[model samples]
Target: AQSVAQPEDQVNVAEGNPLTVKCTYSVSGNPYLFWYVQYPNRGLQFLLKYITGDNLVKGSYGFEAEFNKSQTSFHLKKPSALVSDSALYFCAVRDIRSYIPTFGRGTSLIVHP
Candidate 1:
């Protein structure tokens, strides 16, 4: 079974500081990893993905993620944090043969101004 884990329930960072949200996964085969952000009362917004190619993948809103095959991890990172960046972040993983992706419990990012 494919599974994803976001170790921290919450991550706190000061505005303008770098930030990271951790994630790890377990899959039976090749894995497709994804990161998403959710605002209050809003749906999930795609952030970045790791399907192939470079280990570092960039995505919308200045967000990026690094895929590490050996560690089975795909942690999201931002060079700097903004108050507007505060939200719930989720990590998901899907096995190549599966149609559904397994999502983490989501980590709440609190960017203090």
Candidate 2:
């Protein structure tokens, strides 16, 4: 079964500092990795994706991710953090065999102003 793992339950960062949210995935074939952010009660919003191309992929909200095939990891990164960026982040993975993505439990990011 395809699955994702978010090792951290929460990550704390100061405003203006960089932040990272780690994710690891397991799939039968080439995996489609994604990152999503949810603010309070809002739905999961797409952050970044790694379909095909350069390992380094960029997405909304000044977020970027590096897809490492060897490690089966896709770690989300931001050059600087803001208090508004504090939210619940979920990592997901899917394969051609599955139409739905398997998501990690989620990691909460707290940015202190």
Candidate 3:
């Protein structure tokens, strides 16, 4: 079975400050990791993904994630956060053998002014 955990229930940051949302995953075989952000009453929007290749992957809205195999982690990062960035963030992992993907509980980000 594959699973993903977003350790923090909420992450608070001031506008213009860097922010991070932590995620760790477990899988039996090679892992496919992804990050998504959701606004109020909106569906999840794709942020980034790590299937293979470089350790660092960049995505929409000035966000990026670093894939660490040894640590089983793929934490989302932004050099500077905006109030608009506040939303529900999710991490998902898919195993090559499985057709379905496992998603995290989601972490709420609050960007304060």
Per model, how many backbone clashes are there?
A: 0, 0, 0
lDDT of 3 by residue, 1-113 (tens): 99999999999999999999999999999999999999999999999999999999999999999999999999999999999999999999999799998999999999999
Q: All models: lDDT?
A: 0.97, 0.96, 0.97
- Superposition TM-score, candidate 2 onto the true structure: 0.98
Model 3 misplaced regions, further than 4 Å? none
RMSD of 3: 0.5
**lDDT score at residue 22, model 2, on the 0-100 scale:** 97
**Model 1 CA deviation exceeding 4 Å by range:** none
Model 1 clashing residue pairs (backbone): none
Question: Residue 84 in model 1: shift from native, Å?
Answer: 0.3
lDDT of 3: 0.97
Clashing pairs in 2: none
**In order, what is each prediction's RMSD in angstroms?**
0.4, 0.6, 0.5
Per-residue alpha-carbon lDDT of candidate 2 for residues 16-82, written as tens digits (9 for 90 to 100)? 9999999999999988999999999899999989998899999999999999999999999999999
